[model samples]
Target: MIREINFDGIVGPSHNYSGLSLGNLAATRNAGHVSRPRAAALQGIDKMRSNLALGLVQGLFVPQPRPAGEWLSDLGTTIEGADRHIAANAMSASSMWAANAATVSPSPDTADGKCHLTVANLKTMPHRSHEWPATLAQLRLAFAGDAFAVHGPVPPAFGDEGAANHMRLAPSHGEPGVEVFVFGVSGGPFPARQHVEASKAIARLHRLDPGRTIFAAQSEEAIAAGAFHNDVVAVANGPVLFAHEKAFADRDELVAQLSASLPHFELVEVPDAEVPLADAVKSYLFNAQLVTPPDGAMTLVAPTECRDTPSVASWIERHLASNGAIRQVNFVDVRQSMANGGGPACLRLRVQCDPADVDPRFLVDDAKLDRLAKVIGDRWPNEIASDEIQSQSLVGAVVQARAALLDALELSELG
Candidate 1:
């Protein structure tokens, strides 16, 4: 049977607020505030448990090494004498948002009948660029079988943000689907992150049918308003597309193209009259994780922030009132991650494959999740403020904590 599995990134022990991300509001607003690393990991783990409870398949990805040595070495700087910019980028735990993990094209959509994955170079931001190598390692390990083909990131000239800039809409998780690749030009004040060329390169590399892929430009206004990644404005599950009115540069044209391509296309547009784009960005209304479970209607797994925003809350009430596909909503508290500019959807990467085909060590069960939580609670730091990021004590602590986590997860090889 076809299954949709969510592989969530475990918050690293070095979780801290340095505000390194440019277009994320939470990152800027919460900069320098003290962060609770232990709590952050537990919160993410709890989210995994929540999904598993709903009978969905869940997987886990351990955080990449903190105070990334590779970045410092590239700039010919030592950790002890690193400047503020270098230090901030080194300590970035942004990889916890696995939605940017990689762009995935499942078996049914590829010509060779093998699932394909291409790591995102993430060259737009210095902090995120360091993630590809480490992410590639994990992708190779978890998807090591005849059923998969995992490729490295494209050349750095074209900036790619992975699944964050791509969405797939199919009749079922296992069927051949239409892939939407969203790209942004650099007219906005905020640096446009995903490049159109990069999206085209990935689509070509995956050997996807040219007719099955659609290329659309992101709105420059949306980018300036902090919709750095397309996920901030739109999301897709099965054949349903939920987005804000200003999500794309030309929403009508894009929807028309999708309808023409797919057998049955469903679009749920939140108009500017009811909720403005600014409010959607602030509340992460579209960033909420939308999942279709077995034997029931689709459910929206949203962050608690959505409920707190007046306009967003009203939209949710109206959506439920219609008794549409999104019949239920589960609000989760991932404030620690949210403060770093990621919501529930940001923490996970969706892949369609059979559970039995995956590496046993990478797959998660309730017992394994509980053990992982205990490890984070017992070893991860209580707090890490921005000012203390470069301190020697915090450095040692970050290193030791990661080692402990690797050991606890029986992944010492990765450590």
Candidate 2:
């Protein structure tokens, strides 16, 4: 049976989560070079892309829209565009903080085959007494079938209490049982204590064991050596807290520890590189967005730049390849970008996938599986095709289904 999953939207003031809202600052800094609308649009597009990609796989996309009062005036068109795209894809979408909604808490009960929306009031600091009932009502109306839960009124200390950001849930499939890891906050310039507290609260609600969670610690050694970001990324792979390099000797040490302790868990680590923040942001968002179920495997798609970084790509490839549980390794081609920071995994997020769907044997049977393999290859262009045809299962059916769907999406988007 397909288990139901529930997720909360990280509602905040800025489009990007966990980082400073550079929208206004970027505008002032590049006033002559770029327009405010263009800048906002770029960020908005990234946000929309992240949300939609997750929605496509997860079967639900819930976002706290720009605050209720500001929705029509500031974000109505964007919301409408997102709605249209989601509907076009035969997916469900809803806003937690739409104009008529109440305070953004008290998530609703789950409903079958529908998406839920739970809003958070971004205007209030340490928003202690918001009405969760109304929010719950909305969610109940939407996602009634899935397991539903609520997290936070993040404490005042995590960055700006009023800003919005999301917490990611990582689920892994084990042969005998399933394992789950929930990460509440990630990305650069970490948030304050309250944010971490809020994440802890959410993790508890989801039944994640606190003992197993990893916390992000600050280390001057990492910063001095310029390995801070990569260090944090490795720690963020866990469910409880963010990891820092100061806490360990290096990335390998951290990975080794995680491997020893949580042998079933997937460890995602970023490399130390000089890349545009936008691309980095996208990579983080993509990872969070593409979580597989507790019993399934996932493939990380990042740009060629990540591949070139021996410390980053080599480590990731080695981990996935050696790990008995990992199903596949695929690379994304981000060569189109002038800056060239992202790859396949960076651009897409996996919300949901049945373990039954992924077939490693498909890689080995390139010749006989050509037709189906072509469809899978096109959808996932970064994966290296193997010559051996280990399994011919579902090759024909998957190819046909994917081709038809791709054609339809192309026609609809073009129209």
Candidate 3:
């Protein structure tokens, strides 16, 4: 049977605060703060466990090679001798945000009746541009069978930010769905990362029905306010699409098109009056994982920041008081990721496929989580101060930590 499995990236030992992302407000604001890599990874593991308790299946991707010495060398310098900014970008643990890893099309939505995954080129940011090759290798390893097709990436000329800008709305996981591709043209101070041409290329490559697919424009206003990716301001699961009021350039037209296509589409749009755009982006209010557990009503897995922010918290309370599209709210502590400009939703890539078809090693059970935690607690660095990123000892530990994880999981080929 087809099921929705959320594959979350394990936070890397190199996870730090270099603020490599320009459009992400949270990252820029917290650029030089000391980071806790150990805590950050443990937090991610805990998130997967919590979701498991909610009766959701979970999968994981190991952090890619970091202190990317090879990438720096390709750029005509060594890690220790390169410009600090360039070196920092090479050491980035931003790979933890797996939502940008790929845009997945489930078999039900594809003409070939096979799940398809297209890894994002991510050409807009230098730190992220080198990620696709690693991400592609992982995807191929996990979904190597005929049940799935893993494509490399769109041309580098057209920037593709992956699943963060894509949403699928289906009546059920096994049924056909309408895919929405949200692209941005202007981000004011920041460059809009996902291009329309990239989205169209993915649609054609995925073999999706043109009539069922919708290409919507992301609002410039929201992007300028720091909602860099579409998922930052909107997300969809099953029959529901939860978004902030200022999410789209043409909200009315998008809603009409969706309603006309989907018989049970639920539009749970949070109004600007209740929670303004600034608060929405600040608290990552709309970046929640809207999931339908085994049998219960859909629930939202949000970051703790949502509860801390008064307006977002109040709006959530109001939504829960009545029977809304999302009935329960689960506030998880992923502050490490949040402070670096991501939240619960940002940490995962949703793939619709049978759990049996995926590489068993990537699928996590309680025992796997326990084993993973042991490796992390033992080898992951305790803290990563910006000034200390260049330390040889720190670099050695970061590399060793990743290798240790691969060894524990018996997937040493990745190392």
The global C-alpha lDDT for each of the candidates, from Candidate 1 onward, is: 0.89, 0.29, 0.94
Best by TM-score: 3
Best candidate (score: lDDT): 3
Alpha carbon deviation, residue 245, candidate 1 (Å): 0.5
In model 3, which regions exceed 4 Å deviation?
A: none
C-alpha displacement of 263 in model 1, angstroms? Answer: 1.8
Enumerate residue pairs that collide in model 1: none
Model 3 agreement with the true structure over 1-415: per-residue lDDT tens digits: 9999999999999999999898899999999999999999999999999999999999999999988877888999977787889989988999999999999999999999999999999999999999999999899999999999899899999999999999999999999999999999897888999999999999999999999999999999999999999999999998789999999999999999999999899999999999999999999987889899998679899999999999999999999998787889888999999999999999999999999999999999989999999999999999999988878899899999999999998889887
Residue-by-residue lDDT tens digits, candidate 1, 72-92: 898998677899878888888
- Estimate the TM-score for candidate 2: 0.40
C-alpha lDDT (0 to 100) for residue 245 of candidate 1: 91
The best-first sequence of candidates by TM-score reads 3, 1, 2
Q: Please estimate how well model 2 matches the true structure, expressed as its whole-model Cα lDDT.
A: 0.29
Error of 3 at 71 (Å): 1.1
Off by over 4 Å in 1: none
**Each prediction's TM-score versus the true structure:** 0.98, 0.40, 0.99
